[model samples]
Target: MTINKYPIIIISLILLSLNLQAAENYKKFDLPLDLINYMEISLEGKTAVMTVFAGDSSQSFRMESLEDNRSYHEISYQGSVVLNNEGFMSSGAGYPFDLIDKTDVVFDNKKTRILFYQKDPESDVKFRSRKKNNISIFNDINIAGGDFIRGSVVSFWADIVINGEVNEDVIAVYGDISVGQQAVIRGDVISIDGKVDIAKGATVYGRVQASGGKKKFQFDRWTRWHNKEKDFSTIIRFYYDRVDGATPLLGVQFTDEDSLLPNVEIYSGYAFSSEEWRYYVGLEQSFWLKHPITLGGSFYRKLATQDDWLMQRNDNTVFALLATEDYRDYYEAEGGYIFGRFTPLSYFNVEIGTLVEKYTWLDAHTDLWSMFGGSKAFGSNFGSVPAAERASGIEALDGAEMASIILKSDLDNSDREARFGQSFWMGTAELEWLPDGWNDDFDFTRYFVRAGRFQSLNEYSGFYIKAGYGGSDGLLPLHRRYFLGGLETLLGYRHKEYSGQEFWLGNVEYRLTFPKTDITGLLLYNAGQISEEAGKLGDAEVKQSIGIGVSFEESLRLDLSRRLDRSDSSFQIYVRLGINF
Candidate 1:
């Protein structure tokens, strides 16, 4: 659905054109402040109404929150109005007003379109920053007449002024790009939310494009505030599963650019079915000596799962709600850990951590129901048990405490610029050790490695291959074992039909992307083996499947797969969100 922004834009232009008004000119409405982060005040003659938004959108704020006292204000209607950020709401025009710092807001009563202030081409901040770096954030860039920049000049939340020559693209985000007389640009000149002013004598060898206006610029500020990339932001999330039922979670994350500390995250949630609370708090600090290194620690009590390789939480929730089928088991993990990470290269990182955790087995609730399949109850949470053990009875795992040293490494070169069929590859390795001398009931060492590569045949097609291996050197805990034959791993078989202590799997796919569209087609093949023996993957009977599917923008997908190893095998239908590997 397309939203019409013309009315909002017209309202904003009028308010910005008027000069600052005196405080006594217009009548004030003493509306009570609510708990939302945004407040709006709409005026119609002598009557003024107040309302607040959940974050920055149009959603009505109904519940009280203790998240923060800061909020953005929106004021509307024609009048000489002065507002102090004392908890009043606005109705029409959306101008960004910081309630904490800005003591007064003035709006115009006349209707007129106004443009943002233009940056001076000869400013020193721009000229000095040009030679130091080609890119600036929250700061303007100026290229003097005599200066020649050999590469692209980019500014984020800032403006760009050019009187000299630029060899590549000049881009400004939420800011303007001004090409002075006699200036030359070899590449595209683009402004995302601001204007582009090119003098008659200015030479742009490439395309010139400008989109959005000043009113929308204020909207972008609200967008950035609530965006995950923001330095400080809070998020509200809802989750569902057979074990937890319905869970509502709230999270806050903060980071300072100029400070030594780089990141902090806190989350708290409640599970309605289990009637339990979950929480997490973590912090990370970065040190720059010769290379960048980070040290961090966290404490958390969470509904944990190890089958992320099979399906993500949100995708599994859909299956659980619609069909009473959950592809993953759940457990309660309460733990605290400290870790250090080092990134010697942009696409690679290695982390070493020590984890101490107490684990409790979770039971699937039979009383809770799904939208469909109301007659079927949830399966036992116990994982990978043999046939004889399942025939006797399924029992919850004994609670245990264990300590382990963890080592992990990741390498990837995926192209973030492309939506699909990018020629990239990634690999990861992890190892965990629980020594017996630590007085823990579990004594084992586990290791897993996975790697994948994608080769773009062209803009229209691609080929992908992936393989993984997992095995244990000691007595592996029930929750720490391996399983195969599922939607993502083995499409033709039942969920987790193959369970064992060791496993190896391989998958290959050929993808075709239609031109000028988001639709894509795929041909897939899968092979895997699993066994009770620690290193019997090679000797175990191999299972195989072949399938075909289509996807829309790499999101929703449907596939029909059939087993190649069995004569009586039939086609199985599967739905998925994305390619897991």
Candidate 2:
């Protein structure tokens, strides 16, 4: 045993070497918290520099050496100096610094503050400009308490906290904006890539905005002066979606200073299969700084296929049709609609509006089919049809005016953990009244309500449930009725397979996410019933489907679904470029 002691020592040394090699890949940093509040710290080799902003002047201090997170100020230059009672060191070699005058930066006249300083021969601390030592886009200045900024306060790459009044706009780019309750901003409050929180009683004379793209690095250097800065911004997004029938779409939005209100969007696309034009222009004015009224309007000139609903289909299901490549039938509606919203609280809102439209029905006439190679999917114009369907085509609508009213309650927290760990509740009811006149004989009333919720189960699992019911009264035309099937309702059934003046649908899904990855699996079930009358809704034949699928990074969606009631039913193929479940 004694003879083996030497061999054991050598083996222990080798094990320690391996452990060191594995742990040196990451760099460690430690600095005192008190030093960070006033000055920005940066690392230069093994040294750190603290740059502080005073009333109208700026100064830099070199931290040559550090022991733990404590700062020991030691001047490392010829003219280097240290404030004894203040514990401050100026080591920018050869740079003239007045110790007494710079002491105003921190206000404290006593006590050494900087952690440590040594002669950093690796670089001369004296002649080194703070540019490389730190980066700031503002002419640094700190206002005393109760300070009032009379003009627009603009700073880039800087965080601002407002305790006093800012008579004009306060714009902080690439930084966060904190508005204390006692603080008043007579103008807009905007933060490009950071959060903006206004205290409960804080009064913002203008709009407040706090939003950015997923990539926080997205920056715009369009304006140099805060006052000249435009209160509006434009964003363009390009993506391929299922609703577009695998077509890539170019969408653009114009948002005002406050992200919550007054916006415009315009979208248009050419269908690959439908071979037609689809376009939409929408405008909204909602959630004003001091008011809850919301005004909106839109004008659309596109091929709108009847999906067992609407004189045209412009509801949420419009998205479902866009993923389609070919549509068996469609109608044209070119007109405008105007609506106003009144929200009393975060939980509920009411909207009332009017729509005036002229409709044109595209039917499969005998000549139309024969002339087009006898393909029902081919339009008379040889254009690709939308990959959508309906049970039976309706007689051409008489083209009338209608009034619509809606009440909604939406409570969503899907952002809690970014995915399967959140809760949501949403309920909405819409009523459309087709009044007599407008040179049309169609007069009807249509109404519906939908609600859904998601319950987060731990970090890897989630449960979702949704239900809906729709009904129509009076001379409700076929196109204004409801339909069930497709992704929004019955996934395993064909689009618009069931149509009626009234309908009910429900969906449930269980989601499980793989640990430490974006991979997710889903178990989905869908069922729905449709009827001509509300009384018959309960007895309507039920169409059901069950499905299983997996998604990766939400970029690709693949699913296998089968009809539950059909003996000959086989798994259906549903592939979406964009994830929906």
Candidate 3:
């Protein structure tokens, strides 16, 4: 259902034209915040009244918090406005929509119409942050633009702009904040129920939080914070798997989180997967060289084997593999590498990294099932050329020195979820050298390509498709080979069920977001083929699955699927966070 938007737009324009009186001049009423619990509201001549319990001891403030020198909540009504079951809340129109339970507002005080939020229209979800503080904003405070001017702590109602250094927190309860690109904030910059545009390059020593979300022209701080730093910090993470046993990792990362600096990560990990321990140290520094270039390098001994790698999406999503721990893929590798990234344009990036390491293949399955597929001769992932042709068995080092190049282009214009309306492409070609001579049987050149696109069928619906291909010109060490058969590539199949030098996978999905309720429905299809070693791809057995899923607020998701390739396979289900990235 559509509402008349013109009237609301007019009301918004009128509100913007008026300089709102200080909340004090507007007849404030310290109304009880809990009255809404009973769906109750009472109004009188410019006054609203109700009962409420306050303080840790459930007593009135009476300035006790001030005397005790602590912050406290002062929630109340600014006008004698009456509230009904259809409560009212608004934002960006000289109104600070205090959030309690995200209740809806369904009316206009005047004959004006107001536009209510719809899930599809404002589908884009950027990084929004919240903090726990009892601070209250009351007056107007402005930090005038200047050259390196040191700022002080402030709270205000009128909008604010910071073009200089702020030594303290800046709070805007009823307005927005414009932080200049060069602005340096030593403390938080908070917009209480308002918007904030933090220009690119701005540095915030503390968090930038907003209660009613945020608007942006710069970096999606939340995305960078979580994706870059969080992922780096996960170097210390722990993993559990029946086959790998207990995997515990410990690490420390410096993402320049507290200042403008390069990122550094160091970590160590060990688990039963190979009963091997590894260590790593990495550093990345990004700067503008005509365009933007990130020069980074790392030295590490990490699990380069398929069995030890859980193969999670960069978005940190896990599917059917989370439920089934029967891992039948295994390998081992440890090395150090360095790389550089050059982003010549907004939508494109190219990178190169080189590593020298030792590769070893292991049995993912301790029993008989572990020894099948791939070469057909051994019925194991370590096949023909590498195993049969090698003087030593699979236990050998399989030494290799490799340089890799990766190119990626992304122009996904859709909201946070896997995205739609644009396409993203990434491909790689890597040449590995057998420094130990041609007899080492571990030299090969690998080529990989992956592309995806999201088509917006309408405001509330979209179609998404992903395609992947991987192949190696000579024998790639078992650890360096391609593997499919899980949520990331082929759904409903056993984790890493197929290990081969050449593999391809395809995925298609339709997503629909329900209006008003903020729920999304999804239908998914997956198919893939695996060639033991550059054999006939057209004849390779096809693996496929069909599934359906639902997502709430783009965070939680659940999928149920069935394998079409396996007749004896039962329904497979999964619960994971976010969409495929």
- Superposed model 2: Cα runs more than 4 Å off: 1-228, 231-254, 259-283, 305-324, 327-329, 344-348, 363-394, 398-413, 416-419, 436-439, 577-581
Native RMSD of candidate 2 (Å): 22.0
Give the worst 10-residue stretch by lDDT in candidate 3. Answer: 110-119
Per-candidate clash tally: 7, 26, 2
On lDDT, the stronger of 1 and 2 is: 1
Task: Report the lDDT of model 3 for residue 196.
Answer: 75
Using TM-score as the measure, name the better of candidate 1 and candidate 3.
1
Q: Write the per-residue lDDT of candidate 3 for residues 6-96, one digit (tens) a residue.
A: 5534653453233122211322112222222211122222232322222222111122111122223233233222222122322211122
Cα lDDT of candidate 2 equals: 0.52
For each candidate, give its TM-score against the true structure. 0.61, 0.51, 0.53
Off by over 4 Å in 1: 1-230, 257-259, 289-291, 372-376, 387-396, 417-419
Give lDDT tens digits, candidate 2, residues 1-581. 01223453465456445434433432211221211223333433335565544434657756564323232433332345532223344443222221111111111222222222221222222212211111123333233348776445544456777777776566654567787766666666666556776565455655565544542232121221132222344433332222223233456776554434468988876755335566779998754332255678999866555432221232222333343233234456777888766544334555566676676554432222122233333223112222232322233353533343323333332323243434556566776654434335465677778877766565577778888887776645545666666556777877556666788888898888798888889899988888866567788778889999887876666778888989998888666554232
Q: Residue 562 CA error for candidate 2 (Å)?
A: 1.8
Residue-level lDDT for 174 in candidate 3:
49
Cα lDDT for residue 545, candidate 1? 97
Model 2: how far residue 458 lies from native, Å: 0.9
